[model samples]
Target chain A: MTTYKRMVLASRPQGHVVPENFRLEEVPVPDLKDGELLVRNHYLSLDPYMRMRMEDVKSYAAPQAIGETMIGGTVGEVVASKNPKFAVGDKVQGMFGWSEMGVSDGSLLRRLDTTHIPLSAYLGSVGMPGMTAWYGLTQIIQPKEGETIVVSAASGAVGSVVGQLAKLRGCRAVGIAGGKEKCDYVVNELGFDACIDYKAGNLKEELAKATPNGIDGVFENVGGEIFDACLERMNPFGRIALCGMIAGYDGDPSPIRNARFFLTMRLSMRGFIVSEHMDLWPQGLKELGTLVATGKLKFRESVAQGLEAAPEAFIGMLKGRNFGKQLVKLI
Target chain B: MTTYKRMVLASRPQGHVVPENFRLEEVPVPDLKDGELLVRNHYLSLDPYMRMRMEDVKSYAAPQAIGETMIGGTVGEVVASKNPKFAVGDKVQGMFGWSEMGVSDGSLLRRLDTTHIPLSAYLGSVGMPGMTAWYGLTQIIQPKEGETIVVSAASGAVGSVVGQLAKLRGCRAVGIAGGKEKCDYVVNELGFDACIDYKAGNLKEELAKATPNGIDGVFENVGGEIFDACLERMNPFGRIALCGMIAGYDGDPSPIRNARFFLTMRLSMRGFIVSEHMDLWPQGLKELGTLVATGKLKFRESVAQGLEAAPEAFIGMLKGRNFGKQLVKLI
Candidate 1:
């Protein structure tokens, strides 16, 4: 009998999430029933959204219950199958959680081809994060050519793609990343018009100098003071696509000081979850997949080894310790 | 030649708009030029937006410069006309300000007929406030047939029309007003499903009980604490049409304590000035005008008799002293 290790929620997070809040358990792999396939997870997606799931509060998605497997997205190979759709060794992606193996009935599993891109890219650039950038930009911000767009968390998975996509659409892209190194990479490698180091304690002045014409569109990922600063620099009739508030997931963040600008500036802001907008996924994926496959779109990942590193990796991402898309690589 | 009473901004308001900040002066009205019409002011419209114009700060419109006429909308009778578009004894509306006589170039003047509706109704329900309600409700909120909608300042010009229109569209209308009397008017007279008195100090609990299905759409006029309260009670995928933030006009209102709810609820909020949406005015005004003429839509206005009462009336209106759309009779 084959066996593997998995992590489950031991208790709901109170303030900050710690490793002990998660319980690592070992269990034997279950036998595949008819139409069921067994997936040995090779890569697990660790995101800031997981911190929100740890709380027993209302959110876009249901909270992760105690004693239940930690909810996440994963890419793996079908090691055994009794299904006609998913044969053994077929690459697949699903909500496989923080487990080494998962049994699926092919309903939730989507077959993947890694011929053009790497397997891990399925969880980062061409997957949920990539699709998020695509949908928020096209549907919400809709940056026009020669107009300026500001993106927060500019070195991270979603923001990196957002800024690059803004550039490709013939707009001036300004990025706000945590460190000097990341900001440099965002400017040099990502081809953003300008990258501001948010940690430099001069966001307002730096952003103003970078976007002299005032920002017409903003793809906001990191909310809090960073968002407030961006709000101050927005031009008339600006649009803000609020994808995440990673700063407020752990605790109650300070009020946005410049929200009053929404009125005077005739601004429109919408907070969206990519999963809720399933209608746009097909079209978004087609564009995002082609960009990633052809290497026209670029992305970077900070991968941690083994499923056990998920908790640490996730926490690090929230603190901006991860330089890019944080993921856990399970061999 | 004719002489007229006028109020010019003497000094910018410090905290509250006092009479001294406005200097009452008499000036000889200039002769009408070609393509110009002389209007003897009948009624002057005072609104919160005027206060924004008085400040030196940048706003959607230029600030009311010191020693210049305080800009405002007015309804008057054409006393003389050099333009074929207007003739003597014709009723007209334009931005004539706090003056007894105005010389318009005819470009900004719109001829009015009060045969179907009251002359003042054109300024309140069928004019700016009414159009504001229509655009915000239909374009931004877009409540479904059975969805619940909440409107703030529910007994006032904009809110009264917002709730009634919502009801006409087959949606449940809930209102938040200042006092028991206004709340009663909103529910009993306006046919709203429920009205919550915000002064009662149980907004969170009261709003919860009022909107059992949760709030799907909101016509937000009051901001600060009330907005935060309403935000906390919003359902997932809710939309807020932020029409006004009257609470923040004078000074710093309390910050929205629950803005994080935007992310958790997947909400959309847009702040707009109805003047910017001229494309929809024709359609919106047609609907609003028809409703008022048929007695299906109701509105109330507090008229401060003569131009001298304007400053005090404006100050009173800001404090919620006036029950509805406050106006000044200047004839």
Candidate 2:
């Protein structure tokens, strides 16, 4: 293709993200130089961390620059290559972002085996999200057999894998999700022991009921009252893998009211970004890939049809409107 | 002495502690049996954890039972002994509570050498408070040389030792305390790099000024806005040793408003009670004892004369009224 469509960050969001924060434009596909490959992007992974990068803040990553391609994870098939490492029609995964086509030097691209796993699964269950779950659950939370673990955003890409992995480790995996539909999927489909519908306005009661023995470990994604409830019920020396705080990502403050519980329970909480722990990704991906290939791990995606739908899908995902791992179909 | 004065918990505090919560009574000293020693109490240590124990809450320890002798650490002289391990006139430390005399089985008591260290120093610097500081700093925070560490309640018993020890380990020790006097003592006397007076109503600005380089380690004693301010200034992968939340001890809520920082900064926070980590006490106490004995560690005291003064002194100490280690002279 001589030209393609892409979205760029137009402006930084003041508080809540709106459509105006992004700009969709038609641009010429870049000419490939030596040691470069051109990939036709198939899918773009829209995640919570993108919302954080949209703001001008000191975080693990630099802010997504205005008038630049909005940063994201992508799985695509190489269409053309001048690089010896990558070949035409090779299924690959890289941070190709919100574009229909991308040019890369192969350094950032990883050739994938699409025979057992679908190309789309590389953007969800067997990709960064899966590795994130693996690193946080296995390394940080480290729940022992028969221990109880609570995961927030339970039906999403990361939380789903976390709960499933905990179950495999013989843990009582409890989940807290936004709605009844998501909660049902988390318990029935994803194999979580119990799932609490946080929007039911009875989170405290439901959470207490779900976790009678109290929370031994927490994979915290949505940090607010949900996180506070988990903190209140944390067992002595409980571990919290603070992976994300999507509830407060839009400039709203979500204060932890049970700060005293940290002392009273002698809890240990560690916040982490999985990308910084790249050393474990190979081991994590190997486990995740095997689980997905063996059909032991299940994941669902809420795919927006085109590149233009990326912004709205992301905004909806941030508000917990999307049911599962939100993605954009580029082709 | 056949009869001795002792204080007992008469009731639980409604909000803040009052003198009415304690009852001073004259009781006959129990006769020492085999393997027992009678201690003539010299000083009673008043600390923040006592405030939490006053409430019937599920905490690190069981609530101090009402109408029982109040729980406290005591340094005393062994005046009568039927145990082979004890001798009359030996300086010792034990949990003898708010009393003029105590009967111990010698198993709970530790003999002290007061040749260079004062007998009362065992209650403040080289005792539980000092060991608490050592465990939190060395074990949890684990600061690398030249990294900055912030200690709240910096002039108080545990906090003072933390700052001094952090400095000894080649750390930039910043302190947070109540007033100018305590702040000055922290910086000048205890050798903290800088001190922020929370009472100045410019905690944010003062903390920002004091810690130009973001805090790498935190010994959090007084949780509330002070802890929040520190959280906001935490560097990536910062470690927080949550030792106490005295500000919220009197049935008040001390919410952490900067909870988002836990994820953004990838911080690690651990709440600990020194008594629970008996394995570390020997090493911790050895370092503490040698520091005080060699004059490398300096500690001040806010002495409340006589056993009758304990309740008021404890109440005052909880309110940050005591200058340093709040102690009641019982001899």
TM-score per candidate, in order? Answer: 0.97, 0.98
Model 2, range A1-331, lDDT digits (tens) per residue? 7999999999999999999999998999888899999999999999999988998888877899999999999999999999999889999998979999899999988889988998988888899889889999999999899999999999999999999999999999999998889998999999999999988999999999999999899999989889999998889999999999998998788899999999999999999998898899899999999999999999999999999999999999999998878899988
Q: Model 1: runs farther than 4 Å from truth? A: none
**Candidate 2 residue-wise lDDT at A248:** 91
Minimum summed lDDT over a 10-residue window in model 1 chain B is located at: B250-259
How accurate locally is residue B298 in candidate 2, as Cα lDDT from 0 to 100?
A: 89
Candidate 1 scores a chain A TM-score of 0.98
Candidate 2 pairs with clashing backbones = none
Q: What's the CA error at residue B194 for candidate 2, in Å?
A: 1.2
Candidate with maximal lDDT = 2
- Could you give candidate 1's per-residue lDDT for residues A33-113 as a string of tens digits? 899999999999988788888887777778998898899999999999999998889999999899999999999888999
